[model samples]
Target chain A: MDFSQTAERISLKFSQKGQSVDTKKIEAKLRRLIEEFGVQPAEAERSVTNELAKEFNLPGIGTGGGGAGKPGERENRSIADVTPGEWVTIEGKVVAILSPVSPSIAQSGIIADTTGAIRFVVWAKANAPEMRQDAWYRIESAVIDEFKGVANLKIHSGTSVKPIVEDRALIPSILKVGELKPGIGSVRVKVVQEWETTHERMLQSGIVGDESGTVKFVIWKEPGKERLKVGAVYTIFYALVDEFNARLSLNLSTATYMQDEGDITVSGGDSNVRGAVVHIAPGSGLIKRCPVEGCNRALSRQNYCPVHEIQPGFVYDLRIKGWLDDGEKTYNILLQREVVESLTGINLNAAKELAENNPLGMDEVFLRMRDTILGRYIICRGREIDNRLLVRTCERVKMDTGEHTALLNRAGGAP
Target chain B: MSNGGTPAQGRKEGGFEREPARRVFAGELRECRHQFREGDDEKSPTFVLLPTGERSNRVFLVGTLTEKQRKGEQNIFYRGRVVDPTGTFFVMAGSYQPEAMQQLAKIETPAFVGVVGKPNLYQTPDGAYLVSVRVESVTIVDRETRDLWMLDTARATLDRIDAMAQGLTPDAARVKEHYPALDPAMFRKMVYEALAQIKI
Candidate 1:
């Protein structure tokens, strides 16, 4: 390709600053870099301009590379094909905008095309116009860099970002909960559990699932947004997926909801967690529940329920409210009477006898239960609801000597 | 379960998530020499920086309770030594942990036990820091349970060692700044030795 036009653009940039120009020398350098070394035309222009700027004692000038060529001159590459340390242009929709972690980063988020999605960052020095989330943009001359073993685009002052208005929709195809990564997608899920609104900003948050798996979802309070009821199925469009502690969840801040007919057979909420009973919280062991038909609330110290009036004749129950730690994560487990009785070998009648015989009264039963189960390694199978596991079955974990031996062999081989 | 009233009313009021308890071997646990708080508030959670570059607010361990002694005349307290496969862990339970103290007082010596508690760093007069577990809860366990704990702890330690070797996450990077002389191989060796104690 001819280098005169490109060289003239470089000379005009320096002349705009009232600096002396060397058009012939610039053209020769660009020709050598492109033809001999086979550097990308855009990269070659940047290198040559940077060289000229230093020769003229200019530090930051020519770094933008705006005078390189027209927008259509550079090749447009897919997100998946771009590699680190190369200058390439990519056209993708802004999938998600993550809050910037540093002052130097003006914007940082994931951008995706039909091929795949990749993280992108716009440096404060780039001075590029802010790209709205879910909008399409054609970013030119953006450098690729790697962080945490993942390649991402780095938009600096040399890059040019122009928003695009595509006639076709860039929305990704529907995905199952198990197939979700950190991006934007659509999914049809059943609202399995509804949790109390913990914050004013949260309209609702709960676990949603389908046959594939279950995932936590949060709906921020917004105008004209419909709340999802438990046991109802809905198809969510354009929901942003986020990950924390290696677990994925959905954020429906900028998403659309459609109530779907019928129900889904959910599968993923059931978990089998094995760990020590680190804590046997209070209100465990022998307790009384309000006898008023539908009101099963645990009675207070004086046999009074918050919602129901004083009930002198309350029904007795057994349960264990505790925390279990499986090394990596802790689970809040609620063990019902049957599971607690099987594990502790203390039935409801036996617990009532202990409470009546001891001067400590009901507190004695709690003490006895704590002595029987605290710090024990037990496996519990149950459905997780609002971060707490409602255990259906539980038993002490048996040591697998063969497993330990194999683990030892593998660990010994590790470098 | 009926929801007329929620379980753990006190925990509901706070509405904050609990910090997970990490499983670390006593050998590696003793090597932790740094402690930090995430914020300036007194209520901020304190974390013990593990040698493998992770932080633990609470730790779960199972070992053999070798001995025990009760101290403090006015306010009774209990101190015990628990021996795991790799090394010994000192546990203390005072009035603050009445349940643990009571449990410790009743348990006999040389019995298998499980403990979950926070790590407290005590600086000696000579300027060296010593680590011990402030007992949260203690219970009797079987040899099989202790062996299982050893296996789980070994796996967790190896995972941390690998993460530190990669040095990818911010936790690993921050750990490098504090423990500059830290070596992943040493922790790997510790894991191997700990696992070797559990015989099939």
Candidate 2:
């Protein structure tokens, strides 16, 4: 609403360098950029400052103490306002400190304000003082740069860091399991399952779920971190989201969690797998099940159930126990009667009829079913439990000739 | 009946982990002349280095069974020529693979068949190496299955070619060293040609 305050701030930056400034002219430019042209206040300020620097023949305007401006005179810009290639001051809490991959990067982590959060890197050459985690710092003259379309700050030699006191806490917004990508976020989920710890470095690993869906989570062995109890709800903060085998999982190595009072009603989400039915297990096709109400276990050739003993009046069912190989990994898939009947066009009644007429009995149905489905490429969708996909639906994968043709054409091959 | 009851685990015989069967076209399968084992031990898995920089221990292929011949009176080996769009893959089913041998013996000629097996390279006295599949399982498939396999193999071949073109990883370097005159364009052409056979 008022341009004189913004104009005075800009004039003070130049005045600190002993340059003669025009407050009226700076106010007019800010009014034109913000009111007439509809530019964001911070961006407009930067554009007008760059223009004034060029006009006054002062290229070193915002380069901290090295420049004409004093070290702490520059106003701190909102983290959301900073754009790439501009030098601005930002005051935000250090929410996360990630392990730097390269030696040239002395520290790399996430900084957050109430507006938004962004990645920041302190270069080794900057020789800046270490900023404590969870503490607010006013970073002056930090250069903004972009990597992979996301904006981040690059603290170099010219940047000055100072600890500041702030009352309000800046907490990142919580994200649902379905909305997660490969990044950092907070989530509230109940521990659905705790799987066996596969490695010595793994403190705990399990499936966590919320109202939206479930996701696998792993917490590496870290000091002062507690294990998560199954079926207990918790709000996890600053968890690193990682992707493996195209599936997203939360890595809680550097995260903190708090037990929540309420519970989450999780949805048994479905996943899809596409591959060839490489192998069919022996207990497939027409099988005799125990007639007992709660016991439908497959009966042996002698019409005996393992738990319920011998059962003469056995119910017939058609199913396919097989492995689906998607080139990289193998999924143990259990295709129930409905899915098997839909895929092979052999219903339970037809399987029973085939077994009754043949001298080989149930083996005939197994052989026929294997011939119908094995080596065929299919896509199955269902919920995965204990590393097995309980296939709800199965369909043969039709070749999309047009897509392949386009792909080949793009690869510079004759199509 | 108890709902959500766990199904029986269909563990393969001997309980050994099965190798992932890589999909490769008949043309690419025929060109896999370099075969090497991972270790010197007899039990070490052997892999055939594909020209597109993939080392495949087992391959799943679907093609038309063009011809079949029953050889050796005592051993009774069944050798079949399976033809896809690009080329023919020779498959052999011996006594050790009785089920595959039986299936191959009974299958009619010119029928679409799917074969999952390991590629074996044998050197003749004249020093010419011939690649053939030691059939693990053979089943009668339909035209749609064969067409789908072609598309899948095309995608897989293109992925390997793309990986090889991107950079020389250890596997890609091994492929380059084995096939000194390897040209990714040739595999790309093969994939295109394989896909062209299938109608929309």
Candidate 3:
């Protein structure tokens, strides 16, 4: 599990329980818990999670086995065994106390057992006891409903909420490659390779592998931070997965944390190809950028940059993304501003002039430019970056103008 | 899928990929009956199948601008009709399409023009769909450019046919699925017919 993501989720859980806890402070505490106190990362996570819940008087989440109940009073159930339309007595720790879905709702969030986690909702009008984060709960007479295919518990006037204590740890299950999805997940992997940054916000990217297989990962970290050393094993916490053509790549953010778990070797390589330009993706024309120093972020919707905040000083830029096909296979290629301007003969200033003269005309000009080279052949050099060729060098293969002219003349022309 | 098989993540919202503007005939554009969605994401691409069975998000064609008109009382919009050898293609430009709209406003009718644009498939409540080109670019080109476009489009269409025969492209699979009646031979005939229309 990406620890940073776990920390973030934990902090969010505490905040939703109406606790005043600083996220940065939590992150710092988590780091110290693992490094100084020598607590296992998962155990450290539980401690911080439990400690905050105690201070805020929040329900225990991820704490195992709770609530007082009599035998045969209600059908006992585990989280993973839940199905639609089942009314059963379930016991689990409150992993997260989510914000009420609406103002009229009292409390709702995820409750987890060793089997799995499911969402629970206690409607406000029920006037049920409030649940706290990380607190164990044994609720009786809760009904199950399938919402969008996921089973969740519904607590109402007939339901009873009880806070009970248990002493088992809530550890994020180590996931495999096939188990990865487009959401938060944690994985243990060997750093097979690491690449230098080529794109913004992507501090470092390369390959990571485990027993199942390998996947690409891009670490989003502050510049100059210590990167995960190649040839080492690390437990990544709170990582986000993004899929491309069925392939997955992991994204690391600030809320995530990593722990070095010694060293292991892994292997992989890159492939290269060349082809003709087939398509030009949209956003191929004039665009604006944030003008802050070292922060040329794309400005959209109110002209804002997340990092530098809102700075109206904008700059013009150009880019083109398209495919290159050499008959057999096709490769996605990216042409940055310089290459685009060089190929299209349309510079930022020229595009700006066109935009000024005819704002919507820019799209037409863009398509016209795409036509000029779409069928032409070209040679581009770059390795694959998420199934796309990050073209480091590009040169157009000049077309045989003589033969094309002859063919056009013979095809049909006005007398 | 509408965008052939372009990956979903790479073409996120706000990003654009120029679909290989298939060289579709005006008649085929009008006769196209099915639309395929590549991805279900909010920004996923939607493509229409020409009568010849090739999928197109964008199209490149050369034609004669037969007429131009500005419509709308509160908002001025530019709409034109371009006639190819086989049939007529309706092209529309509005505030959102300022560039094409302005160009249409300036162009004289009966002039040879080249257009590259997204295929706009409009479906009525009655289940009838109208196919048109959302103008991306409109340029007044000479007859030579028209002939060149014809030959290029013919070659590209032939390539698509060959790819389909070999079962090499994802588009070929979609064509086979949605347009089972279409064959390379039929598309080949259309390409030849289009080329024959170009008088030297």
Candidate 4:
């Protein structure tokens, strides 16, 4: 079959799903195409077959050089064909996309077409661009093959792809605004709040706003932490639907796919809100039991992830995610590790020794940031952390109840 | 003996439609040989489905077949499987005669028949807790009996659909009129409604 036909077959299989399609079925179709495409390399035959299966180091289907299945299979064979290695063109609509995960980069996406959902590896790394999530596209001359028995079709430099449409148009879905809780991939939101620092495990919290609504988005300890700014809003290209506390929330886990290079230039007065510390418990001011940043394992604590097992010195720091009551509602914030260490001049090794010597030795640390963090008004900046609107703490702050009244006024989009 | 040459029929108001030849169900019956007390004079019937004729279709052979003893009082019982489209259900007989036992022994796996008996439904810890009906008066009949039953079932199914389709249907209210105990006749009408919808 020709490339346009191959593209159409795969796209159709994709739209049938009420939601996303599975990855394995797509790969199989690619394998069928690669194996079935090349008949007798007569100039015309080669061109037609090549449209179905692009050149790849990956094993191509062995049709014994007789040729990919006759042109008749085009009308009959679904993208699910068991044909081992043939280049057969397939196509369809992009009804769904996979939440990109990686050995490769952040936000690796998968697209689907008619014949079936073919798993495609995007060598074309980019973020949520002008395209719509459900937009239809035609990928030309992409190599189709099986990886570890799974059929995978990939688009790289050698592959050609074009977003398809009619009536002076391009792209799939019209980007909407609302509180995005993850799966709703492309959205526009604003900075609602930010927490200082929580777990020694870096985590940023914020609320994002959109036209339809606003919801919390969280950006976790992604690769590039320096990329965020407070009070700035921009388009969030990709986010994930995840579950936490039995409820759904959006997460921006892969740093690469947290694509909006644009930031909201919006800002507000830098004030500190202070509240009385409700409570403090064990591990409050404890020394850095975890290994330093370069250090893989926790120096003494078990709360760290296992992937960091063998590294150099670690960046030992303390973090507390606590509630502060300014006489009304209680809010949350994360005090950074460095701030915790700076606030409490004790180094990791010394703190550990002190903690071991006296169980409550770390009590002083929480106390310093307590009142300042509690009743003090924290300077607020908006940033999307983990696909959320976070009030990044600029400085401890508090505004007069009357001024705070005015603050609530702007929340509704009033000037 | 019209087609496959077997005798079985579903229950209908009218009696068997065919001449009573050497009907598979014709024979002398037997009574329970054992008895025991069952909770303040109330006891449960113990009839195993398809028992190979309780030691071969005879409850009282001049000579004893085996030294096995049963325990139940007040009712003469027999047990067998009744195959239906919904699946086979184990049936019991509280007052059937030895002829019923003889018929059961002669009947094959897909036998069709009309039976009568009070049902006692209970639950097992596992199993979907499905109710098993115990059938009595097991008999073998001719093709005419089977056809009559199918026709009756088809008619009954139609009545139910009509009643259900009614704007002023008194289903539950009419049910209470016969009351306390469900008049199976009414519910059986529902079963017929279910059957008639199936394509022949």
Clashes of each: 0, 0, 34, 122
Chain A TM-score of model 1 comes to 0.52
Candidate 2 residue-wise lDDT, B36-138, digit = tens: 8865768877888877787778889999899999999888999999988888999999999998999899999989998989998887899877889999888
Ten contiguous residues minimizing lDDT sum, candidate 3 chain A: A61-70
Two-chain DockQ for model 3: 0.16
Model 1: lDDT of residue A25: 88
Rank candidates by DockQ, best first. Answer: 1, 2, 3, 4
Per-residue lDDT, model 4, residue A99, is 50
What local distance difference test score does each model get?
Answer: 0.79, 0.78, 0.66, 0.38
* Model 2 ranges with Cα > 4 A deviation: A1-268, A385-387, A411-415, B1-17, B39-42, B168-170
User: What TM-score does model 3 achieve against the real structure?
Assistant: 0.50
Model 2 Cα lDDT, one tens digit per residue, A1-415: 8988668767877886788689999999999999999987656776788788778877766343234554433767777666665667888888878778799999988787877666789999888999878999998878777665556788877678989998677676888988886656679999976654666678778789887778899987767778888889999877877765556788886577999998788766477888888888988998888898745667888997765679999988888888888765577888889999999999988888888899998899899888988988899998674356768898988867686677657546433
Please give the distance, in angstroms, between residue B142's alpha carbon in candidate 2 and its true position after superposition: 2.1
lDDT of 2 at B194: 68
What is the C-alpha DockQ of each candidate? Answer: 0.31, 0.20, 0.16, 0.01
Interface RMSD, Å, model 1:
7.0
Using TM-score, rank the candidates from best to worst: 1, 2, 3, 4
Model 3, span A1-415: residue lDDT tens? 2357556756666655566677777888788888888876545665786677666766543332233423433555777676565546788887655546597778877777776666677888766898887788889867676554446688866577888888778665668755776544568888765653566566667778775667888866554344676677888754656666556787654213465756543322234554456556775666667797645656664676655667777787887777765432356777778877787788888877887787566675576666566645567775454456766567765444564554444333311
Instruction: Indicate the worst ten consecutive residues by lDDT in candidate 4 chain B.
Output: B55-64
Error of 3 at A12 (Å): 35
Per-residue CA lDDT of model 1 for A272-336, tens digit only, reads 88887889999999999889864567888899876566999999999999998776567898888
User: Considering just chain B, what TM-score does every model have?
Assistant: 0.89, 0.88, 0.81, 0.40
Q: What are the interface RMSDs of all the models? A: 7.0, 8.3, 7.8, 39.9
Sliding window of 10 residues with minimal summed lDDT for model 3 chain B: B1-10
The count of residue-pair clashes in candidate 3 stands at 34
